[model samples]
Target: MRCRYPPGMPFYAYILLCNDGSYYVGHTDDLDFRLGQHQAGALGGYTAKRLPVKLVWSESFPTRDEAFAAERRIKGWSRAKKEALIAGDWELVSRLARNRQGA
Candidate 1:
């Protein structure tokens, strides 16, 4: 808890790179602790067997709901979309944005 997060915050959005080259998206109030759990095989549910995960990306949020929303959206995204987010490519993100306005 050395992290100086403002009090009352409850979640974060994070990405983990599995040993199989697949990416896992998730959200947690304590990123460090959660990562440790995954690495220790204690939280080995999804990332458990997919051990040796590396922290690839993370974003902190003030609320669990927001973080959960982000995690859900990212989980459904294609690999290219995930890569674009990792590369910080706003252009690519926009180009790949799904057409929701089914007009």
Candidate 2:
């Protein structure tokens, strides 16, 4: 889902498509500022090394904990599952999950 805040401030779980075609999952309370940091290489970590990252997908949550949980969950996903999520293809994500379980 896109970033949608409810009434008060919202936390976000986000996916970044890196320059090297890799994916990075993270959570933050301020999406825009965090993105700016990543783009500017201020964070000095994974996204920094893979500079010029792009925000591919993000979802707003009511609480920081929820956003963090989503980030962790997405981080554990396979490339296909992550791509399915980016495409908003829940069915494909489910099928991929099932296939992984079966394997």
Candidate 3:
């Protein structure tokens, strides 16, 4: 069998655009398989109720630690920040953070 991951490989941090127009953030070692689970309602959580989730964003890290950290960080982000991320608007994200800091 082909190896899905080599030793010491990085994991992935991903964002899903749910049918409810909300976003979900998560981390996984196998992105395709994890996404499949969410799609099939195997995960049976947030994405389950909001099926038909589409992968809108993903970033790989050198380690699961980094991916997990990113997931937690993004989960704390506002909808605008997450939308900025999905839109690849780094400047908007930065501006939002700066505004948040000033508030």
Candidate 4:
């Protein structure tokens, strides 16, 4: 969903599509700045090495804890699930989750 913040500072859980076709999940209060850091290699970590990462999806949360929790949960998701989320296909995401649980 689009990042819409409440009155106070907002937290965001975001997914980045890396150059190597991998996904990177993270949470931050300053989404634009954090994305800049990843793109510039200033973060010096996973996205740094991947270079030229593009933001695929992001959601805003009222609390940092909630955003962090979302990041952790998304990190555990399969690539297909992530793709479904990026495509705004909630039905596919739910289906994939159910199939994974059955597996």
> How much is 70 displaced in model 3, in angstroms?
0.3
| Local lDDT at 86 for model 1 | 85
- What would the per-residue lDDT of candidate 2 be over residues 9-37, giving only the tens digit for each residue? 88999999999999999999999999999
TM-score of each: 0.85, 0.90, 0.91, 0.91
**Runs of candidate 4 exceeding 4 Å displacement:** 1-7
How does residue 18 of candidate 1 score in lDDT? 94
TM-score of 2: 0.90
User: Model 1, 20-90: lDDT tens per residue?
Assistant: 89999999988999999989989757898888999998988887889999999899888998988988897
- Candidate 3: tens digits of C-alpha lDDT, residues 1-103: 8666687787999999999999999999999999999999999989999989999999999887899999999999999999999899999999999998995
Each model's lDDT:
0.86, 0.95, 0.94, 0.94
Judging by lDDT against the true structure, name the best candidate. 2
Residue pairs in collision within model 3 = none
Which consecutive 10 residues in model 4 have the weakest lDDT in total?
Answer: 1-10
